[model samples]
Target: MDQPGLATAATQLCGISHPVFQAGMAGIACPELAAAVSETGGLGHLGALRLPPAALARQIAETRALTDRPFGINLVHRGGPAMFEHLLAIAIKARPRAISLFYGDFARVIPRIRAAGIVAMVQVGSVAEARKAVADGADMLIAQGVEAGGHLRGQVGLMALVPAVVDVAGGRPVLAAGAITDPRVVRAALALGAAGVWCGTVFAAARESNAHPAYRQRLVEADTDMPRYRRGLSYGWPWGTPHRAIPGRGGLNPWRLMGGGLRRGDKSALAGRLSLYAGQGVGQIHDSLPAAEIVARLVAGLRTGSDSPPSPQGQEA
Candidate 1:
């Protein structure tokens, strides 16, 4: 099939060729993966959660080295305003195309991001939050549904949440997240008034991603029911935050796996025990491919029918 020419408000605002976006999933969404997606005409995002200042700077530099296309970095408000300020400062210095914020009231930092000529994208789960984000001067908004992987913010599903967010976005572009794995879901997001789609689970399995080989294989072998969402599935961050991940080998308790000095990004035996954060759409992915190919597939999905994307800008949570 011919690749779709998806030039919507999102693509226009983000200065990208297509509206497809690879979600910045922490641990798995690395610089290599982001650059590959950006190279393929989609907007790629580097995950910056919990990274030290120097590390975040290096990743930004690395992504820039790979591709000159517009890309963004995902930031969370977990570390308090002071911590967010420090991360934001590093991102501003890099001058990326956009900076996506989530998890807390980022209103205070939005102006600074925009002042640096970076697009301030906020991820929200509810209509109220969407309104707040828009009022806070966000250039765009991401509507996250509960079906999404990683730390979730929405209690509603994608089908109902997209339109609700769109209604309160006040003309800002709204990208739909959660269970966004295939072309069908992409089309649905557009139909529901989203300017584009922000995806995580599918991209996590890409060859360029930082996901472990076994984790990538598990995604290929998984079905919709394979992933389970629970509070405190892994260490770090505030307690009671829900995240979805496939159980480790033998279904060991995630907390127990986190013990024994298992460092983050472990690819050995420790890797097998850590939960593979993924969305409910795991069943739709059957193979591991390059990040460019994954972007191609989603871009093709935008042309599955005669549907056209709405005029608006976009985000991920």
Candidate 2:
């Protein structure tokens, strides 16, 4: 067997040249980005959280049209009562290389996914979740830390969570996420027992992603101490759910003072006003290159050991 630190199960499962995975960012994930990453020899992903059935089918078809390589879809399990059923139907039709589930049980869905010959990858934030996911038949596990940009499940940081999940996974592949931007972090994740690293903020500024120009600019310019923002009016996704992003003046305290407005309910607010999701790794984002370029840069960095300096506090990029 290959060394635990080296790329092994991750490459085999996704059939990609590298173990790097483009973490599926909802609203930002697009077919162009997915296909571009896949073309660059990494696993790309499409977020299927908010899409309707027909829209999901169209997105899959569009992605297929862009690249012949394998790609994955990310499904948020707690979206609605019929989410799983809708996802299962879409998975069967799309026949993707892999389907990743977050914040849900995989027991009932894993068999159906396997029956369709699709790999079932589960994202978990704790050791217990990892063990349960493996026993429930997950092909791979994503260890997400609190420093991650989006909704997170645990307070553990990546340095500790990766190894814990790896130990609990019992030989199943584990992908470490949160604050992963540089190649050194990727190497560290591998050394810590993860088969790969899933990066969301690193690619949020990618050219192919659907993030707004202002949002992309913020990622390139934001600093590490940017106050992470969240609203109670939207979805009560647990208080103190740390989201690292470029904090605005007055921090996010003003948002709280405003009683956590329903700004997310308005689509137009997503471009710049609402909380722009990002990770501490945003400091490493220097350019808004294409997905292929981003993958190539990561692969190159891993090979050459290049590391970008951390950004100043309170800055965005």
Strongest candidate by TM-score: 1
- What would the per-residue lDDT of candidate 1 be over residues 6-33, giving only the tens digit for each residue? 8888888899888888887766678999
Query: Per-residue lDDT for 166-267 in model 2, tens only?
Result: 888878889989877766667677779888888888777788887776677767777667636443322333445444444433455443222111122245
In order, the Cα lDDT scores of the candidates are: 0.80, 0.73
- By TM-score, how accurate is candidate 1? 0.90
For candidate 1, what is the total of clashing residue pairs? 1
Consecutive 10-residue window with the lowest summed lDDT within model 2 = 256-265
Cα lDDT, model 1, residue 221: 85
Number of backbone-clashing residue pairs for each candidate, in the order shown: 1, 9
Cα lDDT for residue 280, candidate 2:
72
> TM-score of the candidate numbered 2?
0.85
Any idea what lDDT model 1 has?
Answer: 0.80
